[model samples]
Target: MTDQTRISVGLQFGTQPPLNTLRAFLLGARAMTLDSVMVIDHFQNVFPTSIWDRDLTWLAAQRDTPHEFFDYQVLAGYLASRVGRMRLGVGVTEAIRRHPVLIAQAMMTLSHLTARAPILGIGAGERMNLDPYGFDAAEPVSRLEEALQIIHLCFSTQGPIDFCGRHFQLHSAPMDLKPARGRVPEIWVAAHGPRMLSLAGRWGDGWYPATVVSPREYAEKLAAVRAAAVAAGRNPAAITPALHRFMVVAPSEREARAMLDTKVVRAFALMAPPSLWRQAGVDHPFGERFNPLVDFVPGRYDRETMNAAIAAVPSAVVAEGPLLWGSRNQVVARLRAFGEAGLRHVVLAPVSGLVSPRAALYSLWATGRIARSLRRTSPGDGTSAPLLC
Candidate 1:
């Protein structure tokens, strides 16, 4: 098979910063060689929405920054206004909390506004968002599947869309929304479980697996997705496997680790849960294991537990896997390994300053250090993007 490799990149933003800040990030991300800019759709400004310490005296009192939480639709629409060609995505819009019709409508509008550069990524929402809305957490697997079907039907079907499922029932509702250029935005599913992976192959155009996954593990998952695609009578090669990598780059390993340990890990510690640590093979006193692979730091648990939970997961090990952290060459080498493993796109998590601080600074940093390295590698015989049989 011809490699036909094209590198695509995205930025993951959690909190809804000011419109200007987002605009700057989008502009900077584009300038930095980032192929896309993504915003995680959520209501909470901070993770572990439950905290016994209202003042957080345990971690040494740092003044809590007054947070402004923006609705995902508003943020995405605003973001669409500024960028011309850069791909815009929702890191994940939760299926259960959002009505499929509304979700589809919003994405279609955004796609039109951006002149057809939109990637819709959806996932099962966390308890913090779904529970308060009185949703049963146990039904996520079913809810997500049903919601996906509904969303796809709403976007792809012409005129009225009617559907009935265990979780949702849409009755022939009329929808005039049309995607700007082609069909509705490309659908990307953020998933980890076997069933979800299978669902991605069956319904998704792309898969956004997180940073904790090793290239080997990703290879296995990709294989599974391909199998699922074949079983579903879809073209296996039609699905694009993209990895989401959290990173901190510097001149040396120590400096890189320091930046990640202090900035990325620490900032997110209060939100990290036992699930995250379980994935990292770390034990916590809270009687929980953190699995960084599937855990979302914010909105998972409370601050104390979140802090203690993440402290257990070794940042170095997590970084060593799919993530590109360390010197430029080292980051490049790790990414090269993934590219060889059949990864064609990389979505970088730039948990750093606003884009004004450096327009596309992180993306530019990654492209300069990593993307350039891959370009020099010549795709090694032009067979890099294919799954090994």
Candidate 2:
């Protein structure tokens, strides 16, 4: 006997493709009932400039800039018309760049267009998205807390909203758009820290953490979220337990593990805080007291510095970076273990695809197989989204 909810699988492309390519991609996805398609919002990426010139990703050779990103909100609006029946939204966008009221309005608009419940994934602003553009990255949790309050106020009521807080102040701001008749928009917060986790419980429809945490640690953090929900007099069950995970699938376990030593993969590990690097007896290039990934500025590093830093990262460190890797069976087993830890929804990113077209094709196929193996569904359940299977 098991108490697992009907788990949903979602696909999240790490980068945006050309308009025609994206349209065709979604056309294919329309055949499956995937829970959601999440777009990443970023001005700069986690990968350093050096990797862009290498064979890390196919987009490298075609790019005008090493770090190029289309506006996620605009892309979401375009996708609303194309994604046949699946939910569509950005994985996480901060209120730091866009005002909280605007985010609320955008969610309201998308709800009317999409056939399924559209999700609004929020997070404390990332440094790369903020620092270069002159936005204050300090007290991000506090700012996000206030932003959530404002956005929540706008959605939960139809009246004028007035909120006074440390990071934001709103005076009788009018936001009067209602969601589709029966479709309610969801807010998935990317929370990992203690204060952020509590906010996820109090305000979010889903606790969508992107960090790499052990299943045991996920259970512990999940419990904290539930406790916070209970303290707020809300049903803890209302919040979907969701995660954003990176995976690598190859012909063999050895090949998969070997892929972790690539420039992009090594850079991914470097995105982790110095403490994680320290645990593996590796020195973080940015220094022991360096800020976390969310606070890191990737654009500032010269190619030489980035290459040196990435070279410093060992494959073993990447393996223990908490990223999922291995042959198909190993990957599936790990996902199943996480599913047992109350993971109801997950957005999977296959990073090995960056290595080559062959790796990408194999990973794509393996992902479908992996999804079919782990996601349980009732027979004849027409709503079951294809996990790429």
Q: Whole-model Cα lDDT per candidate?
A: 0.64, 0.77
Q: Model 2 lDDT vs. the true structure?
A: 0.77
- TM-score, candidate number 2: 0.92
Using lDDT, give the best candidate's number.
Answer: 2
Model 1, C-alpha of 222: deviation from truth (Å): 0.5
lDDT of 2 by residue, 1-389 (tens): 04474456777874455677667556645545566788888887776675577555665876645567788878888889887778887888999999998998888888888898888999987888898899877888989899988888877777888888998888887788877877778899998888999999998899998775567777888998899999999999999999888878887777976787776777777766455677778677877777556767877887788888878876656776557778877766566566767888887778887777798778767766666665654323222322211
* Span of 10 residues, lowest total lDDT, candidate 2: 380-389
Residue 233: error of model 2 in Å?
Answer: 0.8
lDDT of 1 by residue, 79-183 (tens): 777666777888787776778778888988888788555888887666555555576667777888888888778677887878878878877789877777663
RMSD of 2: 4.1
